[model samples]
Target: MKKRTPKPLVAKKLIQPIPEKVEPIQTEKIENVYPLNQMIEKIKTDIGHSPDVIIRELKIGSKRVFDAAAVFIDGLANKDVIQKVLQNLLVDVRETELCEQAEITDLIKNFSLATGELQVLSDTPIDFNQLYDAVMSGDTILLFDGSPVAFKIGSKGWESRGIEEPSSEQNVRGPKDGFTENIRTNTALIRRRIIDKNLVFEPIKIGKRSKTEMTITYIKDLANEKIVNEVRERLSKIEIDAILESGYVESMIQDETYSPFPTVYNTERPDAVVGGLYEGRIAILVDGTPFVLVVPALFIHFMQSSEDYYQRADISTLIRLLRVGTFLLSLLTPAAYIAVTTFHQEMLPTTLLISLTAQREGVPFPAFIEALFMEVTFEILREAGIRMPRAVGAAISIVGALVLGQAAVEAGLVSATMVIVVSLTAISSFVTPKFNLAISVRMVRFIFMGLAASFGLFGIIIGLLVLIAHLCSLRSFGVPYLLPFAPFVLKDQKDGIIRLSLWSMTTRPKLIGGQDNVREKTAKPSP
Candidate 1:
């Protein structure tokens, strides 16, 4: 028999193929008028008969001619508001004469429901989706017998954290109040700062199951329409089961997924958000999260603090320069040290080199391993401090770092010089104003360290070039990440590395702010 040819083995798929999108199930509408009992039962069935779903039945009018019932969630709807609504229907309706001439539905909506704002769900065929959504979202639903429509009373109330000074973005002198978990409260805070009628908060609903409330806030004239539309389009495309935090939305809507740098800016401070808005950027406020997300973030935006604009221009400029220096120091210090000690020992002074050599003489590992060990230890300590309870977290981190450094040096696992370098690197990383940016730096620092260990100074220079190219290529919602530096706009340079005097810097960012870029035309003030 002829020798059989060997057959090749095929690899099986590790991931299952994604299923095609399924059409949403169409819910049947409640055609015609539903009786009071039937409507209440239908609602209870749809929303589930939980203990929190309260349905109270009562008679309307003096003669009890009409049957009525009120449905609301227990904790979601304000008890005081629900009580007032019931009083109007029970006591107030009793006082009014029962007349067939006046429609009971109109009478209840016009006089009986004494609430701030309400919507009438009047359709030829009642839509149960609206009814269910209203009931679940802290609205009181009023059902009347023989009425084709239902009354949706706005009674949204829930316990939430009150406004306090933001812990993360604290400044020496600025607005003390910050954004709260309540979306309405956050919008109010923004509105209080900017009284302009042109400032609009357009509402949108996201998340299939959670039905999270979100708003796209921007100044109509100042913000570029294209950017606003782009933001809306991106947000509308997010199809998720739930949006528990702003970060979820940020990750979904951001332009770059693989880049270490943050394309979107998030903050708890309302002033920071308002400041972005003034610069023609858009702010997205998510319900139940104090942190709001600002879009079209540039590289310089993360480095500059809200405090920069609040202080004297000279002082702010100096501080910003210092921050820039610290940022570089944090990113390159470890890599520089590793490169110098490993391959470029000649770069150091004779005495410094002698000291470093003496310090490293007792250590067994090479420069790369020593630095990596110390960096990883510091990262663990930092993470522990953050995750631990606040009362002892700072103490634990401080004592842990000092004790571990001492023990490691004594044991010769790492050298004294390596410990000092790591300490300086950690301290410099904290100088970055934005936590997200700082995290990006922390992550990139390791790559640079690895590069330095491989090819010394040449590897570091190549890495820096690649990093700059990557940053220049990044686009945040269609705007360049390095807005002024890459494009080299002379007018916008005032706010780029160094912030010029407020009056001297007359225009908003060229690409971000729309054509109406003249922020102020005032001449420089003279002493």
Candidate 2:
């Protein structure tokens, strides 16, 4: 027993294995050979032997020391530029004999390739990775035999939609030309409006797979430095696979992820972008989407229209008031109907209450349910209209809504007053100048209706307070979302909620307009 106890008294120590030091793996660098034939074979292998890639092989120089090839994608590159380069190397060079002592590279580069904008990659040949990008971007690449170099020739011509008026943001007065899907064409439209030397269009490529091109357009002197840097920083941080449209970027960089409100504004009209730029906000234009995103969007900005500034101040002010009034109505009408009918019937006038009560007498559902039924049906009809063929969408939407509402009322599924209320709400939602804001209001209305059904007007009040609190907490690239309202900047109010005369709005938006807030002198015209 003593020997067993002594053996059991020994303590066991834990043994830890030493961690291995891992070395970083090196990637193999693919280099092009001196012969043009090898480079062509390598390209064919690299691009997976795609049939769309056109590789036109031809001979160059008097002795044909360099057997050259022009490579480009069939649909992307301009056939004219490719043919011209070939004519210069093959046909044009044969007409004039190359100097016996002259270097072929210099003779071809200086004399033959001088017609178009050409870039010679003499520094260890063109990287195949870069060559793929060039060809995909509609540029032609010329590789030569016995030369470790290639020429990237500009041949970026493809069919694109011509400049047309924006259908969404139509105005009574302004430039008819809107932004096109082509980025360069979009930038040119902005440049035509803002002729100032300080205007800058900085290009960047986002989306790993799509490689979508985006341009950040802003006035250097007028835009705040911090805002511009923040814009660039957020864009650089985007690591998505593809950006199919401007809305994708908007959803990515927006501050409030859960809120229904849009922190970033988008418009197809070039004037709207130019207007945003002049206010010291940065405009982001994405290729292949007509909508351009404008940052630092204020709540008041969504209530405004491109037509607001085009007319007399009095007229714009009236229209803006109507929009604001309708916006509130759209958001509250259905909820108010629910609250009064379910919880506050005494609030309505005696005659109106009698009429509503009589209409709802045979209805099977409660007030909230009736309102919800009509609203959902209207939404379905609207979506169907939008998804249907454009030629018949409008007609279908109008007929569908009319027939459904009338049938619902006749069947005693909902009260006639409830039908009228939902229809009015739907129409009022369209009064909002910006569709994004209108959509936000549409979503928020549902929440309000739920609240009203649960706790009457008190619930609606709580929802509003919560909404305002959330908006106050939100920002667009560090600028407050509820500008000139929550913080209450008096100077910015001249353009907020109402339109003043053009001369009266001499100062740009106080927060984003940088130190140069004064857009121009506030000199009033003397009659």
Candidate 3:
């Protein structure tokens, strides 16, 4: 039999050609420069002539010689700033002699504009992209009829929710101010806390269509330059159309994408970001998001609270220990219950075993199903409470949980002991300070529950081993997820698991802080 040659494989055409390199926005200078009238028309057309966009034509430099226009968005640009610019150009310029040959751009930039923050778009031909970005970002733009240059005055203003106590990260003894949606306000809050000149806020604009503003802030002297550069590189690689929230940037720049655990830490408290910055961590603040992302976040960081540093060392240590214990309880309680009741009934004492057995007597399902049903029900009620309207949300959650749990117990669908276990677990889960970490625990709980159901107590141990291994392998911007624990940094022990006295923590975390790790050099205080 003659073996026929295999048919030649057909090469398939790709739907889209992949570019070898993705370029960052605003890199290339726009060469197309149009005259004043044509530029105004282009702006109107490009911006779809939105009613909110206001363009007021006026003459500048006395004698109405130099024709100019003030362009800005009505709501975004501060009305006062626009008025000040108009006054300077329209009213203030009248006193000066009309000069046709004088440098009007220089005159307006130097002597006319009252704003503190202003930028000259260009000396020669104005970059339209920069001009468009300026107007869109709430800056009032000044255009001249004959000159190619333009002025971008910092006039960003929009109605934003005032800085209020963060609902999610409330503390009894710490500052009440939290980060607002405005990026500038958030940076100011941080700056207020740390007035050092070394503290830096490097700005960059991301997203193609959204052109969302972002800042990567870190102390130049303390932050590890390698980590900062890694963060910068990752962010630069992002080529998205829009970044609606900090979460978008977090998802793009995080080290572990598929892991259930969050590699990036986010919080609404400005104090928290300040603390992270002091610890040599870089914070990524995105415009329009109250939650700021802190990088190279460790497992211990999530377990800690800003209040920890505010309170006495002993009290904070005790509270932190309680939190760690409760976290374990929340993760292991249901799984332990399932394993003991299903496979190792011998592990329970005679009296408690008999009581649990009696409770399960009326229940039709196995221990695993009973626990799973109650946990899921509680989670549903919790989600409902959060999503529902504020006035009715809490009432609905409480009423729903009580009614559902009581009804289920009465109907013999779940054991009373199972309900108690689930309630304890849910309450314990809330003890976790970081919402993202709590969510990770919640998701891991189910896996442990499944493992317990299949292979009993042995399965739980195996699951925990795998979980720890996974966490050990994770990194947040090159820093280990379980820093100071897996790496065993003795110096960082002062602030890990339990925080020592403030003076005792003389150095920052070895892996995170650069060579300049000495935080303080004072001796311990004593009376």
- Which has the greatest TM-score? 1
Candidate 2 off by > 4 Å: 1-29, 63-65, 94-102
Q: Candidate 2 versus the native: TM-score?
A: 0.92
RMSD (Å) per prediction:
15.0, 15.3, 14.1
lDDT tens digits by residue: candidate 1, 1-527: 98665311111211122226423323557654544556676776777678999998987665434677888899898999999989888888743453344567767777768888888888756788877889888899887665666789999997889999998887899889989999999999999999998899999999999999999999998999999999999999999999999999999999999999999999999999999999999999999899999999999999999999889988998999999999999999999999999999889999999999999898999999999999999999999999999999999899999999999999999999889899999999999999999999999999999999999999999999999999999999999999899988999989988888888878988899875788877788889
Clash counts per candidate, in order, are 0, 0, 0
Worst 10 residues of 1 by lDDT: 7-16
Q: Is candidate 1 or candidate 3 better by lDDT?
A: 1
lDDT score, candidate 3: 0.86
Tens-digit per-residue lDDT, 197-227, candidate 3:
9999899999999999999999999999999
Candidate 1 structure, TM-score to reference: 0.93
Looking at model 3, residue 474 earns an lDDT score of 95
Give the better candidate number (1 or 2) by TM-score.
1
Global lDDT scores for all candidate models: 0.87, 0.83, 0.86
- Compare the candidates by lDDT and give the number of the best one: 1
